[model samples]
Target: MGHPKFPSKHYDTPSHPWQKVRIEQEAGLIHQYGLKNKREIWKANTKVREMRRQARKLTANSSDEQFQKEKNLLLAKLNRLGMLDENAGLEDVLRMTPESFLERRLQTQVYLQGLSSTVRQARQLIVHGHISIDGAVARVPGILVTRPQEKSISYSPASALNSDLHPVRPGIQETFEDEVEGKTQDNEKVKGESEDNAKTDAKTDSKKDKETETDKEEEKK
Candidate 1:
């Protein structure tokens, strides 16, 4: 622990700061995830590394009496955070990527749940105290959301966004209405095709009936 005013950095900077491949990859992630900077990616990568390091240590000490207990605890924690499955093991933990951690952030979750059009908007809503988890405001966009907490994430009751008339609400409503309209159009197209097929079948039956009547008349002649 360091001074309260100047706490330690929770993440490590890359060894080579000028790698072209890495810089390009980081830029893509930042844009795709609407991250503020490369530092967030670095922080997520550091978390993944720490988790993998613990997994490796646990794997090496499989014969220890406390191994099963510690392994279960670690897997449980990861599962609770929605990062791993119930049946996941140390191997899965070792394979975890930084994106796995990033996806669990509140901003990403808000966007994924359709509460926000983008992660940047999600961040803005959270930082402005418009977002909440379980009725309590969460101002940190980078905070990791647990599976249980995720279910309760919504706009704070005090925020104007809680109302359907809010400016942001119209955008979301329009997107939903557009999807509904598209489905309705598709259904109408299918119905039209079915009606056309029925008419064709009826005309074919009438033509066959007329041919049968002409054959009967010729036989009578």
Candidate 2:
């Protein structure tokens, strides 16, 4: 075993690192989930890969009681983690994508439950200990949140975010919307200024051209 002082890598690197399509897909996923880097995506992929591998092994040993028991245990764990439904079977586990695993993360769930305005903001709140689950502070955004804990997610009692008047609190939707609208208005103003500048430049160029032509005619006279 490796030294306990240094943690081992949690994800497997891509087999074809130079593949353009795979690179684009990884970039898209990173942005979509507000992931810190491609490593988070790879970690989710690794987890899904392990689950599919186990499901394949169990499928081959369909007659073995021990394998069946282990399979049930695996399914139950996934169900508790909110990665699968109550009626989900081995097929569902086998078909699970990395997105499904990512969606179960506390950060994603916080944004989905409207606790935060965005996934990155949720991560920030979680890491800063503003978030609580089941009355305990949840400092890790990567934690796999269970279905039962979903409803229990809220701002820590001691956190300023727990107050309804907090700027980032979910109850203050108008503040967030106004901020967005303000940015949009600023962008439109900038765009209008640029367009006006372009028109002014075109008119000035035409005027200069006419003056130059008149000067040339006078020179010929």
Candidate 3:
């Protein structure tokens, strides 16, 4: 028997060049939003596709009864996303791109709201439980945030606020330490050179003074 966590839609490939093109387009989206992988992108596409199918099915209905039901559900979802206008409909949902999905991702939200400087750091912060929605902590970087929650999203662990979102990340602290030590060494060298210069100047002045006194005595003779 297969293992519980084994391959189930876990190893699949796109069957067409159009699919390849879609994946390429989404890769740009992935990089833009700092997504972890293509799986997240596919999940968003599936949701959008299902919404489109539902809307198309309702469009064929004659009476207002079934249509209104489908429309209500669609509007509710779109409204939650803050993308539903008074006249929003199936066309609006169909028009959504990978960017729309990316915008709702916790990583993208964190970066947009200025909780983290870079997209990658924003992702790390979200995954590390440093972020929250409506006052409830969320540790999943892939969690899609809706509009009302989007405005209310915040970061927590107050002490973590002052620290770098990705503090253990390479390069930053190491570079800072290197620069600080280099400056200290440079300052000490400058101070020592300045003191030596001052002493040399004093000795030169005294030698000149002695020479002048000896010349005066010779003149007197």
Candidate 4:
């Protein structure tokens, strides 16, 4: 991919009014991919442009084997990302863009993997060193996980140890349910105690009133 010539500032609009629709598209990509900035999208665009450039170059000769080789490489990469299926064809590779490449990233895939609650959380978990892939610690949120490796993704035992039921722990949600039930029981107990206290106070007041009335009668006599 060519080195991006653009500045690092976040772009709200493309400067040209004709590119106004791009702002919406860019924002959607950022939200959907959980990107940190618009620069990332631009970076992906350049990267895809480079890939397309390579494809165009390789196919300039128009040899069958060259085309197949390029297709295979793209397929392998995409399959590693868990995007393309087992029966994907060369036509699919032609349709592959940088967005397709980005979608396969570890952060996005992990979110789609249903490990973390959201895309950003998946990225955070990865960057925070809370996640692992293929039984090896993978701290890079941008790591593109293969389908087989995706199965291997798991939480660090330490990270899993102490927390309210986060998405990382399936067992923790059940524990949370138990905790809620316990709280409900505790609340019922408190209510019962409060009712008992009210009854006792009422009885005491009644007794005191009767005693006062008797004292008044005695005084009168």
Best by TM-score: 2
When 2 and 4 are scored with lDDT, the better candidate is: 2
Worst 10 residues of 1 by lDDT: 164-173
Per-model TM-score, in order, reads 0.77, 0.79, 0.65, 0.60
Clashes of each: 0, 0, 0, 0
Question: What are the Cα lDDT values of the candidates?
Answer: 0.93, 0.91, 0.75, 0.73
lDDT tens readout by residue for model 4, 170-218:
4565677789999999999999999999999999999999999999999
Candidates 1 and 4 compared by lDDT, better number: 1
Error of 1 at 138 (Å): 0.5
Q: Rank candidates by lDDT, best first.
A: 1, 2, 3, 4
Better of 3 and 4 by TM-score: 3
lDDT of 1 by residue, 178-213 (tens): 989999999999999999999999999999999999
Sorted by TM-score (best first), the order is 2, 1, 3, 4
Q: Over all chains combined, what TM-score does candidate 3 have?
A: 0.65
1-221: candidate 2 lDDT, tens digit per residue: 79999989988989987999989999999888889888899999999999999999988997999999998999999999988888988899899999988999999998998988888998999999999999999998888988899889988889998778878876586687888999999999999999999999999999999999999999999
RMSD for all candidates, in order, please: 10.0, 7.0, 7.5, 6.4
| lDDT score of residue 70 within candidate 3 | 71
Model 3, position 23: C-alpha lDDT score: 69
